[model samples]
Target: QQPVQSPQAVILREGEDAVINCSSSKALYSVHWYRQKHGEAPVFLMILLKGGEQKGHDKISASFNEKKQQSSLYLTASQLSYSGTYFCGTDAYSGAGSYQLTFGKGTKLSVIP
Candidate 1:
């Protein structure tokens, strides 16, 4: 099932911080974060496994809480380049070596001067 992303949209000034949350009722095997600029394909940002450790790169970081079936993306000291639509794709194991990925509607993030 598709996850639900909170805030749906966000506006921040450069150097500001923002948080986006994703939640799903179904069990999750992993949560994948991606950023897609206008007219550009989504770009992989990070992935947090169900039992794996959190991940971070540059000003972006993410955490997964398997028990809660939720994930949160942290953008610290946000930059102009961070402006994009953030998508959280959730992967669920369906047994028999099958997995399904469902993406959230997306959270639009805009950075101001």
Candidate 2:
């Protein structure tokens, strides 16, 4: 089943920071974050695997908490370019090392000057 994402929409200004969260009842094998601009395909952000943590980067980052069955996306020093809809795709272990992803509804972010 699809996970639940908080703050369906967010509005920010340049140089600000925002966090988007995703939570699921099922144990997640991995958490994939993506950003999609209007009329565009979602662009891959970061993926947090089980037993691991955030993939450190300059502006975008994320963390997976296996204990809480949740993941959070952090956008720091935001830019107008960061404006888009973010999605968290969660994969659960099906069987035999196979996994299937269930994507959250998506969080919309808009930036103003």
Candidate 3:
């Protein structure tokens, strides 16, 4: 099943901070965070594993809570360049020694001056 992202949209001023959340009903093997700008392909941000791993990319970070089947992305000191739609991709085992990825609807974040 696809994960669900919270705060479908958000507006932030430069230097502000924002948190985006993703949750799933089934157990997650990993959560992938990505950002896509206008008319551009999504760019990889980071990934958190089921072992409660926390990861960071520049000023952005994320944490995974396997027991809760949730993940959260943290954007610190938001910038205008950060304006984009953020998506969370959840990985699940498909029982064939492989995994499937399901992406959320995404959270749109607009950073203004």
Candidate 4:
């Protein structure tokens, strides 16, 4: 099943901070984070594996709690460039090498300069 993201929208001024969370009902093989700017395709942010490995863009960071089936994205000192919609995609391991991902509804963030 797809994960659920919290706080549909968030507003922040430059240099501020915010957090977007995602939770799923089923165990996941990996959790992927992506950000989409208005009128643009979603860009990869980060990925957290079930085994606790992490990978992705340099500026973005996220943490996953395997036992809780949840993940959180933290934005520090937010900037206008950070304005966008964030989504979390959960990849379920079906033990058949056919894992697939489901994305959350998304969290919209607006940052003002």
Candidate 4 lDDT, 1-113, residue by residue in tens: 77999989999999887889999999888999999999999998878988756443545678888888988898888878999999999999766779988999999999998
Q: Report the lDDT of model 3 for residue 108.
A: 99
Per-residue lDDT tens digits for candidate 3, residues 1-113, read 88999989999999999999999998889999999999999999988888999999789999999999999999999999999999999999988799999999999999999
lDDT of 2 at 40: 100
Which 10 consecutive residues of model 4 have the lowest summed lDDT? 51-60
* Candidate 2 segments whose C-alpha is farther than 4 A from its true place: none
Q: Residue 55 of candidate 1: its Cα lDDT?
A: 91
User: TM-score of each candidate?
Assistant: 0.96, 0.95, 0.98, 0.91
Whole-model alpha-carbon lDDT for candidate 2? 0.92
TM-score of 1: 0.96
Worst 10 residues of 1 by lDDT: 50-59
lDDT of 1 by residue, 22-96 (tens): 999998999999999999999999999998458998889999999999999999999999999999999998789
The numbered model that scores best in TM-score is 3
Ranking by TM-score: 3, 1, 2, 4
**Pairs of residues clashing in candidate 1:** none
TM-score of 4: 0.91
List the candidate 4 regions with Cα displacement exceeding 4 Å. Answer: 53-59
Misplaced by over 4 Å in model 1 are none
Residue 98 shift from truth in candidate 3, angstroms: 1.1
Of candidates 4 and 3, the better by TM-score:
3
